[model samples]
Structure formats: structure tokens, C-alpha cells
Target: MKVTILTLGSRGDVQPYIALAREMIKNGHEVVICTGATFQRFIEENKVSFYPASADLMALMESEEGRDILNGNGFSLLKIIKFSKEKIAPSYRKSMDDFYQASQGADLIIYHPKALGAVDIALYFNIPCICLPPVPIMYPITEFPNFSLSSKKSFGPVLNRLSYKLVKFSELPFIKEINDFRGKTLKSPKRKAGLYTYDINGSPIPIIYPISPFLFKKVDSWKDSVFISGFFFLDSEEETLPNEIENFLEKGKKPIVVSFSSMPLKNPSIFRKKLVQALKKTNNRAVVLTGTSGMRFNQEENILTVEKAPHRLLFKRAKGIIHHGGVGTMSEALLSGVPQIIIPFAVDQPFWANLLYKKGYSIKPLQEKNLEVFELVQALEQVGNKEYIENAQKIKNIIQSENGIHRAVKHIESVVDNIKKE
Candidate 1:
């Protein structure tokens, strides 16, 4: 079978799809990853075919409009949209062409949120396409509120349904643009924009949530079409730590690993200073992994900074982790059996952090807005608690035991087989 996975965004968004593609190739299928140009070498290095679909994510982040968003200006939605239109119009058009070409001659299409146009492309080709969301937002469920919304208060089933309605209506602005692209490019019948995400009548499409049920339990209100496979964790063949990291581990008691991969920072200096202060207050040594933002610091005997390191390898030796609560990072931390101190910025991160806290695996997450050194210290203090460590280990065991990638492969194969039978 030939499969093309359309995806974009940071490594957190793109990495899991690579895991899935690698698994498919091992199972005797051809797979290609359609993503940004920056990941071409990385994907090819992983032995997967690469299809460049957009500009590098870091380039997008470093753009003026992206800087505004990253700086926490709290711009209104309309202003943000307007900025995106002006900045991204040219690149987005080119990306659409790349996506259309990359998707040709595929047995199946799997897509993330950033590639919603893949739905129209798949429809044009009359092939099966699956919506794979790393988070729990696409489907409506009464079990809990949508991950995007900050509220956890439950009213009733009606309100639960309304939450999805709110998210659906939020797409109104982009609907015309998306439909216009379909009309011009694919020349297919006009599609209702909401159908790309939902089925107003029944189950719209196969929506797969590639996260552990242990982390987010299956909600009864979800439609039959939804499948909650465990997280598609990518365990690299090489797990060796770098010499400096090894030396750091040998030189002191286990240190907390702090990282904020891809989370835009308004002030790197303040953030760095607070992190150092928090570690000092807790009397903990630390390793900081800063990416793209070039977060730098003066060398200290107890602190080490690196551009990047494998979380799967480093988290196992660390006493605790302080991170942005990204799903990929959370999965790595959980599997490593390390307690976490989450400083969530936006978009489902706070949701994951709060779930961990509610499940007793970590303290309540500290919001990035107005974050202070004292609050970080307090969270670190909680990490030493016996209950939190025990809970972290329990969740770790659950995650470690699952064969997530194989299970996801099975799910994908089933979806493809059923489509063929039809």
C-alpha cells in the first residue's frame, strides 16, 4: 500500500507521523511524509520518502507576524487572521500546489489539522482519508469540555454539543478561502467546510486520536467512528547520551530537565533567569534544551545548555521535567517515569497539563502568563512528593506497555481494508 501523510507545524506535530510512516514501511508499505522543507533531510535520514509542502516552521515563527503572536500580544482573532493573510498568502498558495502534487497516486491519505485541504484532495481522488488528531478536539464528547477551551465546568449534554458547535462556527472565516481553493484547484463539488471536521448527520469520517486511553479516557458520547489508539511514540534506535550530558549526569544528583521546545517566548532573558532561580531555590542541578529561540546562558557548574537532545534518552536519567506540556514531550516524560512541571502557553498544552494534575501525576500547571520564579519553585517542590512520583511511575508503566505504532498501523490497515471492500 502507498500512503501519504500531510502534516506541518513543529516537531511535536510532525514527529508522530514519522513514527507511523516508519511502522508502515516496516510492515511492507510505501510511505511518504508531506511536510515543510526543513524536515526533508530529517525525514530522509529516517528512511522515509520526503515531500516538501511548506516553508520551515522556524522561518514562520521568526516572521514579523509570527513574532507578534509569539510575543504574547494577545491579539484579537480578526487581527491575527488579517496578519496571517498578509504574511502567508504567497507561501500558502505554493504550499497548496506542493500538497496536491505530493498526494498523487496514494492508496490512502492521513492528515493533521494543518492539512485540511487534503480532505478535498482525497475526495477528488475518491480514496479513503483519515483525520488523525494528536489532541482531543475534533469530536464532540460530553465526558469533558473541548481541549481548546479553558473551562472544565460541565453544564449538560446540550452544552457539551454546543462546545463543538462553537468550534465549528469558528471556522466560518476560513471556509470561503478553503472552498475557493477546492473550486480552483480540484474542481470538485463545493464541500461544506465543517464536514472536513464533523459529520452533522452521522459519523463524518474516521477520526483517530493517537493518544493513550490511560491519559485521556474514551468518552461514551463520542461517535462509533472515533478510535483512541495509544500514543504513536517514536523510540529512536540510538539512545546514547552525549558525552557532556553523560558527564553532567555523573557530576551531580539527578537534575531536572527543562525545555520549552517551539513555545514562543516574549523574553528569553526573563524566562532563563526565572528557570535558574527556580533550580537554585530547589537546590536542583539542571539541563536546559533550547531550540530555534537560541536561548543561551552563562556557563554554571550546576547548569548545562544544549541546542537539542533526545527526550526519550534524557528524561530517563533526569529527576524531573519542566516543559511546555506538548503532547510529544508529555508522552516522553510519562514513558520515562519522571514527574513534570508544565508551563503551558497555548493550544491543548494546558489541557494536557491539567489532566496530568487531576490524575495526580504532577502539580497543577503554571500558566505562562505572568509566570514567576517562586511559582516554578513551588511546582518543583511538589515534584519531590512521594505521591506524584508514584503516580508518574504508574502512568509510565501504562504508556510503556502499549505497542502504539503497531496498533495505529492495524487501525490504518483496517480503515484501508474496509474502504477496499466498499
Candidate 2:
């Protein structure tokens, strides 16, 4: 069978689906990944067919407007809607065209919620589409509001369920372009506004959420079609640390690994200065991962900075993990059995950070605006507290036991088998 996976947003969002594609290929199926043009080479390097379905989000995040969104204390659902309409709406035609062309002759479509075209595109082809959000935001949870919209007080469960409408709000800005793609491009029937959620067969689409049940179990309210598969990690080859990193790791205490992953920092200089001072004040050492996230720092005697490293490998050697709480980073840290210090920027990050802290996998999340040298030092010192470390290891054992990619593949095959029976 030919399988097409569609995703959007940052590398954090697209990386897991690439893992999923590889799993499908291992099962003797043709696999294609339709994502940003930036990932075409990366996809092909992994031996999966590549199709550019969206513009590179890294470029967007680097833009001034995108920086504003990230630096904000928290992103309200309303702010995201405004941002998407203003920045993302203009690119819809090209993105829809890309997805339309890439999806041709595919038996299945598994998509990130950001891949809004998948719903209509699946309908156009009469194929099954599975919603595969790497994060738990797309499914409603009774405990909290969606992502960054959470407050010090509860908005209550009614609003908590409604907050997952982030998917609908995020896509609202592109509806006109989606309609244009339907009418002018695909010659497909125009569907009404709101989420184009149901499959062509008039069934509620199945959703596969790749998160460890230990982090958040399947709630009673979720439907039969909603699955809580464990995290889908790539079957990575053995990787070696760089000479600089290797030497640094051997020098002193196992240093904390600090990375904000793909989050763009608005004031990186201030952030980096505070971090370095905090580490020194706590007399702890660190290895900072500074990718294109705008966190550039000169290597100090006690702190080392590298552009990239294998998180799965590097995290396990660290005494603690400090990061922006991207779902990908969260999963890797969980698997590493290392306690985390989450400095959430925006969106679902706050949700995950709070959850981890409450569950004793990490310290209480520190907001960037409220960030201080003393507070950071306190959190860094807390890293050695035995209780948090023990809880992290317990969660790690539970996640390591579950086979996320294998379980996800089984579900995909089951959906296809059901289609055949029909």
C-alpha cells in the first residue's frame, strides 16, 4: 500500500511522522512524507519519498511577526487565530496545491492537525485519514484548557473541552484559500465552514496520538477512535558525541543538557546571560544546544554550547534537562529518565510543563518573563533532589515498555483493513 503522511509547523512537529514513514517502509509499504520544502533533503536522506506541502516554518519563526508570537508570555486561542490569518493565510494556495499533488494515488493520509488540507484532500480521494498530532492538544482533556491558554485558576471543564477548538481557529484564516483550492484547483465540492473533520465515508476519522499513557492516560470522555499510542521514536543508529562534547562530559559532574529545541527567542542575549549566571551561582555545569532558535553563547569554562546533538543519547548522560517543553523534547527527556526544567514559551508547552511539574517529573515550570537568576538557580539546584529523579525514572520505564511505532502501524493497517471490508 502507498501511504502518505502530512505535517506542518517546526522540525519538532515533522520529525515524528518521518519516523512513522520509516516504520511503514519497514513493513514493506511505499511511504511518502509531505511537509515543508526545507525537509525534502532530510526526508530523502531517511529513504522516504518527499513532497513539499508547506513553506518552511523555520523561516516564518525567524520573521519579526513570528518572533512576537513566540516571545509572548502565553498564546491565547484568539491570538493564534489572528496570527494565522495574518501570516499563514497568504500561503494557502501553494500549500494546498502541494498537498493535492502529493496525495495522488495514496491509500492513506496521516496528518498533523496543522495539515488542514488533509481533511478535504482525504475526502477528495475517498481514502482514510488519521489525525496524528504529536501533542495531546487536538483531543479534549477535562483537566485543563488547551496549551498556553491555561490560567492560574480553572476556566472549568466546559471551556476546557472547547479549547481544543484551537485546530478550528488555527485553520480559520485559510478557509478562503481552502475554498479556492477546492473550487478553482481540485474542482471538488465545497464544504461548509468549520472543521472539515469527517471522512468521505461519513464516519468520524480515527486519531492516533503518540504520547505515553504514563504522562496522561486515556480519559473516559475520549471516543473509541482516539488512541493513546506511546511516543513514535525513530529507530536511530548509534551516534557518537562530538570531540568537544565528549571531552566536556568527562571533565566534571554530568552536566545538565539545555535546549529550547526550535523555539525562537525574542531576547536571547538576556536569556543566555541569566542562564549562565544561574548555572554558575548554582555551581553546576551545562551543555547548551543552540540551533537556529537564536540562542548563541560563547563557551564558558563551566558551560559548553553546541549547535546540535542526538537528544536520545545526550539526554541520558545529563544530570538534568532544561528546555522549552516542545512535545518532541518532552518525550526524549522522558525516555532518558532525566528530570527536566521547563521554560515554556507559548502554546502547548505550558500545558506539558505544568503537567510534568505536577507529576514530579520536573520542577515547577518557570515562565521566561518571570525568569530570574535566583529562580533559575533554585530550579537548577532542585535538579539533584532525589524524588524528582526517581519519578522521572519510573515514567521512563513505562514508556520504554510500549512500542509506539509498532502500535501506530497496527492501527493504520486496521483502518485500511476496515476500508477493504466495506
Candidate 3:
């Protein structure tokens, strides 16, 4: 079978789909990944076929407005909407055209939830497609209406519903634009504009969520078409660790790995200073990953600050992790069986933090604006606590037992088989 997988965003978003693609390839299926142009080299390195999309978004994300948006402030949604209106929508149309032209013989399409055009294109071609929920799948869960961070709500179910209503209403224009694009480009009938709805082609598309049940409880009313595959991390064949970091870990004192996971710190100097002060307060060593934000730290004997390192290789030997609570980062930390301190900045970070806290695997999350040296120190101390470690170990066992990529492959195959039979 030939499968085309489409995803966008940062490395966190694209990596899992790559993992699933690789798994599909190993299972004797031809696989191709359609993603950001920046990842072309990454895909090539992985020996997977690649389809390039716009590369400008990554640069846009590094601009001042982009940084603010990432920090959970500023007009991110408007900027995103404007970008989509001017740049992404057109890009999507072209990319989908290219994908369809390239994938002439594909058996199935697996798409990230945000890759809205992929679904439309699949519908136009009458091909089987599946949605991969990189984060929580939010439409309108009666129990938790605010499952999507895009919604605006403080805390109640009514508020959540109101939030969803507002968000849904806000996107009506974009929905119409997308449907019109589909209608003109593919000559298909118009359909609703939500992430998971029946398209013009009258196919019931399945959404595959890559998170474990431990983080998100399955809603009873959730469509049977949705499949939950546990966390998928594309294992990088090249594992390189700095000699200094390796030596620091071998020094015997438990080291806390601190990272913000590519989100820019709101105030880098202040954040770094407080982090330095917090590490000084504790005897444990520290390795801080400053991802593209250019936060400089005073290099001390006990503390090492680097631009970036692969989490899959580094998280394994770390005593604990402190991060931005990205789904991918959280998955790595959990799989490492180490406790974490989640300092959620925006988007799905808060949700993941809340979920981990409820699961008893993380310390109470420290919002970036409200974070203090003492709070971080306290959280680091709690990492050594037996209960947190025990619970983390249990979660680790469950995650390790599940073959995420294989499960996803099987589900995709099932979807194809069912479609063929129909």
C-alpha cells in the first residue's frame, strides 16, 4: 500500500507522523511525508520521501509578533488568520495540488488535524483519509467543552461551550474560503468548516489520536471512528550528546533538565537569571536547552546551557525534566520515567500540564509569568519524592508497552481495507 501523511508546524508536530511513516515503510508499504520545507533534510536523512510546503512560516514564527504569540501574548490568532488568509490558504491549495499530482497511486491519506486542505483533497479524489490529533481532539465534548485551547473560557462547561461557539463562529469566513477553494479547484460540493466533519465526498473519516489514555480519558460519546494510538516518537538514528553534558550526568548528583521546548521565554534575561538562582539554591546539576530564543546563561561548572539537543537521546539518563509541557516533550519525559515541572506558556501546554498534574506525574504547573526561583526549587525537590517517581514509572510502563507507529499503521490499513470493501 502507498500512504501519504501530511503534517505541519514545529518539529514536535512533524516528527510523530514521520515515525508512523517509517513504520509503515518497514511494514512493506510506500510512505511519503508532506510537511514544512525546513524538514526536507530531516525527511531525507530519515530516508523517507518528502513533499515540501511553505518554509516562510518558521521564519515568521521567529519574528517579534511570532515570539509574542508563542509566549501566549499578542494578536497570535489574528496574525495566524491573516497569514492563512494571505499565505497559508494559497500555499495549502498549491501543496494539495502538488500532493495529488505526486501521489497518483496512493492507497490512503493520513493528515494532521491542522492540515485542512489534505482532507478536502482526499475528498475530491474519493480516497480514504484519517485525521491525526496531535493534541486533544476538540469539537464539542459536553463534559469538557474547552478541550481546545483555541476556545476562551475560565473553567465551566457552559463557559467551555460558549468558548467553542465563539471559536466556531469566528472561523465561518475561513471555512467558506476553504469550501470555495475546494469547490473551484476540485469541483466538489461545499461542506461544513470544522476539523472533523463529513466532507463533500460523503466519507466518515477517522481521527487517530497519538496520546495515551493516561493523559486523555476517552469520551463515551466520541465517535467510534476515532482511534487512540499511544505517543509516537521518531527515534533519531543519529544520537549525539555533548561530552560535557554526558560527564555532568555521570557526576552522580541528580541533574534536572530544563527546557522551554522552542517557545520563546517572555523575558529571557529574567527567566535565565531566575533559573540560575533556582539551580544555585538546589544541589542538583542543571542542563538548560535554549531553543532558538537566544537566551544566554552564565556557564558555570555545574550548569551547562546549549542551543539544542535531541530530547529522545538526552531524556533517558536525566533525573527529572522541567519544560513547557508540549505533548511531544511530555511524552518523552513520561517515557523516560522521570517526573517533570511544566511551565506552560500557551496553546496546548496548559492542558497537558493540567492533565499531567491530575495524573500525579508532574508538580503543580508554574505559569511562566508567575514563576519564581523558590517554586522551581520546590518542584525540583519534589522530583525525588517516591510517589511522583512511582507514578511516573507506572505511566512509563504503559507507554512503552504500546507500539504507537505499528498501531497507527494497523488502523490506517484497516481504514483502507474497509474503504476497499465498501
On TM-score, the candidate that comes out on top is: 1
- The TM-score-based order of candidates, best leading, equals 1, 2, 3
- Could you give candidate 2's per-residue lDDT for residues 302-352 as a string of tens digits? 889998898988999999999988889888998999989998877778778
Global local distance difference test of model 1: 0.80
Candidate 2 positional error at 288, Å: 0.9
RMSD of each: 2.2, 2.7, 3.0
Q: Which of the two candidates, 1 or 3, achieves a greater lDDT against the reference?
A: 1
Please, what is the whole-model Cα lDDT of each candidate in the order they appear? 0.80, 0.81, 0.74
Q: Tell me how candidate 2 scores on lDDT.
A: 0.81
Model 3 C-alpha lDDT per residue in residues 135-213, reported as the tens digit of each score: 7543444445554554223456555545555443433555766676668777877766564453334556677788885
Greater TM-score among 1 and 2 belongs to: 1
Between candidates 2 and 3, the one scoring higher on lDDT is 2
Candidate structures ordered by lDDT, highest first: 2, 1, 3
TM-score of each: 0.93, 0.92, 0.89
In every candidate, how many clashes are there? 0, 0, 0
Which pairs of residues collide in model 1? none
